[model samples]
Target: MKLIKLDAIDSTNDFLKGLSVTQELENFTVVSAENQTKGRGQMGAVWNTEASKNLIMSVFVKDFVLNPNGIYQLNIATALAIIQVLKTFNIKDLSIKWPNDIMSANFKLGGILIENTFKSGGRISSVIGIGLNVNQTNFDNLPKASSMAVVADTVFDKEKILVLIVERLKANLALINTNSQGLWNEYLSILFKKGVPMPFKVKEKSFMGIITSVSAAGKLVVSLEDNSFVEFEVKEVQMLY
Candidate 1:
């Protein structure tokens, strides 16, 4: 894997996208920044992290041959890879909040944002942007945020953690090539609030529902109070605390 370490950048994903347009990039190439000035999150939310205090990086997956119809498989693979890496550190209560937000207990530890470049036929490449709270101890107003250091009661080498995650991602990609079914099953097993009735807000309406499973297209499948199942794409509904 080729790794590019930047001192600072607007966004690692943007940098990787720029690189892709300017020159050819190898598969599994990684770009990490000590400071990401314009770090982003799912649905255009800002990923706020103190400079050099968290893992702000993007991985380029080039020429991956997986069918675009099962793009959620990529989401499953990425989430599981991060979870596996955190498990090595003995982090407890790890769960993937719908789609791919990494949570420990009730607090969020990290998140995954994947952007795919597609040809007319199928997906060509992808840039996976991940932001994990590492050494950042204070969330200030963001009550749900927590870091690996705070959760583990010890400091960690950010670079070492990033490397481990990348390695696991490569391994998971290999597994995807061989066992997509296994990866999908494992992802569902670790889903947050699965089988538990939880409050959700659908636009202006609020209701309780249980997360049954995610669709192949990455929609959240929820079994509601009326015994009917509804599928919601990202941001269509909010998982309420």
Candidate 2:
């Protein structure tokens, strides 16, 4: 549970990744910063947060999942942990949008970016970066963005939320270390728009599809209007909603 606090950084993920390479890092070593200049979201999307108003952090964990195929479990565990912690604040309509965006009542609350390093002999180390809007309410340019303060109408202590998230993450991650079957089911249960027809874009083309299960490899599975199923990588598809 070693935690590093920084006033600012280019990217917490990059910092933790470099730290792991240079020296020994404890399991679940966490690095948090008040601001990030080059923060990144899924698929290189820019992650921006007001200084000291959000959670900008990255966690380093090694050998969490035994096999490369099971690595998606890390994403599931991390997302579920955040969802559970936010629920305590009574945030409404909470759901996990596929690939890593956290949603609340159709608005974006946070996101996740996971980077995995595969070592020799089938070992894997992952750097998980999470960005959550805590007390920040200014989203003038970003239409879909909202924060805990705006949504709940109550300012929250960011440290309170961070502590609970870390605590829940450890517990949730430990479950997958044994068997992840139930974890996948729980992830889908609250998955945003699961089984509902929704619009998506692939290669600049748009179509309607029902969100189905997620592949073991972490690809989004969709059932198209033709009743045919297809798997899409993170870069290949875009959710219109």
Candidate 3:
């Protein structure tokens, strides 16, 4: 549970990744920054957060050892951990959007970015970066964004939320290590838009589709109007808001 706190940095993910290259980081080692100048999000988008307000951190999981084919378990575990903590705050309409974005109703409350490193003999280490909107309520420019304070109508202590998330993450990781099958089912149970027809776009074409399930490899499984199920990798399709 070694934690490194920084006043500011470019990206916590990059910082931990750089350290993992030259050093053997312990499991649950965390690097958190008060402000990230170039915070990264999924699909290379920049994550914007007010200074010293949100949770900007990266966690190191050593000796993950899980099969590469089951990497989605990592996403499931991380997302569920965040959802559990948000539930304690009584945040309404909590859901995990595909590939691990925490959402309240339709607004994004947090996101996860996981980077895995493979070593010899099938060992894996994961550097998981998480960005959660905590107390920052202003999102006029970003219509899809919301924070714990905004949705719950109460200000939250960012550090307290960080500690709770890390604790829950460790617990979730332990559960997945033993009962991945059960955890997978729980993830699907709380998945957003599951079995509901939603708008999506693929290559400038829009269509309505129902999300059936996610593949073990983390592909989105969508059932279209033609009753054909299609699996799509991230970036191959976009879930329309």
Candidate 4:
């Protein structure tokens, strides 16, 4: 569980990738930076953040034989780990969006990105990156973004927050190893749009459905307006805005 803290980096995930190639860092090694110059999200979207105002960290783990279906469990565990840490601040209304975003009400609070390295045979390592908006007070340019300060109605100490997050993450990882189904159940309990009708778009067709469940493979299942159920991969459906 070696932790490396930096003042700035291009991207924590990228830093960890480079580090893994050069040296054999221990499993659970963490690389964190105060700011990321070229942060990235799923599908190469830029992860926007104000310098020194959020948490930008990546966790490196090795030698886990992660089944493709269990990938969703990993993401759920990571999001729950961060939520557990934020709970210490008594932050309420925290919830997880399917596949990987954390939110409160309608505002974005954080997100997780899990990248895997595979040899010809199987998976070799996983790099889990997290970005959480913490002390920033202004989001004038980013309407969907909100910070811990804004939601919690107070300021927070970044170092203490990081420490708690690491501890919680360790706990979540242990649970994942021991009882993944249990962890997945807990994740489903907090899933956003679980049982309510919501507008959804698939293949550019707008329709209404109630989110029924998320499969172990991270596919979302929806009960359509006609009471028929369908499963779609993450890219197949979008929550209509």
Candidate 5:
């Protein structure tokens, strides 16, 4: 794997996207930065982090899954990879909030954002940007934010954690082509709030529901009141705490 270390940038995903278009890059090529001025999250949300205190990186992956319908496999495989890495480091109570927010006991520990590039020949490549709080200790006003240092009571080597996560991603993504169902099952087992009653909001309505399972297309499947079931795409519904 080729690694590029930058002092800082606007967004690692944007940098990787620029590189992928400007020149040929090998699969598993990585770009890491010490800070980001315009870090992004799912659905255009801003990713806020303390400078040089977290793992900010993007990875280029190619020739994995060509089927557009199977894109959610990338998310499942990626989430499991990070969860597994944290497990090895003795980070406890890890769970994935719907889609791909990494959580530990209700606190946000990391996140994953994947952007894909498509070619007319049915080939696809992805730039996966991962942000994990490593040594940062102060969250200030971010109530749900926490870090490995706070959760595990020790400082961490951010580079080593990045290497482990990338290695696991490579292995997990390789299995997705044939063992997607297996991966999906594994993802569901650790899914946050599964089988528990929770409140949700849709457009202008509010209701209580239970998160049952995720659809193959990555929609959150909820069992609502009155014995009804509904599926919601990401950002279509908000889970109210």
Candidate 6:
């Protein structure tokens, strides 16, 4: 595992994308930045962060066997890795939101963005980027955002945090290679709002349901008040805030 640290970059994922084509990048190569100028999130959203206040890094993995049904496991594995690391910091009330947002009591603590490059046959590479709020104290514009400092009541050293995350990610990646189902089950155990009643929006209609389980294919299974279950793809439904 080689780490490339930079003072700033447009986006760690973007930087890796550019390099993926020209270079023979190895698996577990990390690209980290002190600041990201144009960070990206799921569905083309911008990932906003204060410079040096968060852990912004990307990991490159190549030669993964792509099971169309198991693609979502990558997100679960990455999210679990982050949560495992945060646990060592003794942060309580931390959990993962579906598809990959780290939350603490409804306030977002971090997020994971996975971008894959495919060749003719299988996955050529995957860039797993993570953004975690660590020391930032204020969240004026972002209402549901929070930092570890707020929850822990103290500051954290960035370098140490990065090291722990890398180690956890490595361990999780190994688990992915061996016991993906176990990893998925463990991920569901820490899911936010799991087994709780909540409102979700689908096709502009709001319905009250309980999150029962997340399918291996990444579809969210929700049980409605009528006891019927519906599975939702990523864009098919939105979790009500």
Top candidate when judged by TM-score against the true structure: 5
Worst 10-residue stretch by lDDT in candidate 1? 62-71
C-alpha lDDT of all candidate models, in order:
0.90, 0.91, 0.90, 0.84, 0.94, 0.85
Candidate 4 structure quality by residue, lDDT tens digits, 1-241: 6889999999999999999999887878998898899998876878988888888999997665356556666688788998788877987788888778888877889888889887666666789999999998888978988989999899888878877877877788787767887888888888887898889987879999998898767888899878899998866788964
Candidate 2 positional error at 226, Å: 1.5
Model 5 residue runs over 4 Å out of place are none
CA displacement after TM-score superposition, residue 50 of candidate 5 (Å): 0.4
What TM-score does candidate 6 get on C-alpha atoms?
0.95
Name the candidate, 2 or 4, with the larger TM-score value.
2
In candidate 6, how many Å is residue 118 off? 1.6
> Compared with the true structure, what per-residue lDDT tens digits does model 2 show for residues 1-241?
8889999999999999999999989898999999999999888889889998999989998877988889899999999999999999999999999877899988999999999999999989999999999899899999999998899999998877888888988988899867588889989988888899989998879999999988989899999999999999987888887
The deviation in Å at residue 77 for candidate 5 is: 0.8
| lDDT-better candidate, 3 vs 6 | 3
How big is the RMSD of model 3?
Answer: 1.0
lDDT string, candidate 6, 83-125, tens digits:
9888888889878888789998899999889987777876656
Rank order (by lDDT, best first): 5, 2, 3, 1, 6, 4
Model 3 ranges with Cα > 4 A deviation: none
lDDT of 3 at 71: 75
lDDT of 1 by residue, 1-241 (tens): 8999999999999999999988988888899999988988889989878998999989999555468786777788889999999999999899999889999999999998999898676657899999999899988898999989899998889998889999988888888778888998899999999999889998899999999999988999999899999999998999887
Tell me the deviation in Å of residue 211 in model 3: 0.3
Q: What RMSD value applies to candidate 4?
A: 1.6
lDDT score of residue 46 within candidate 1: 90
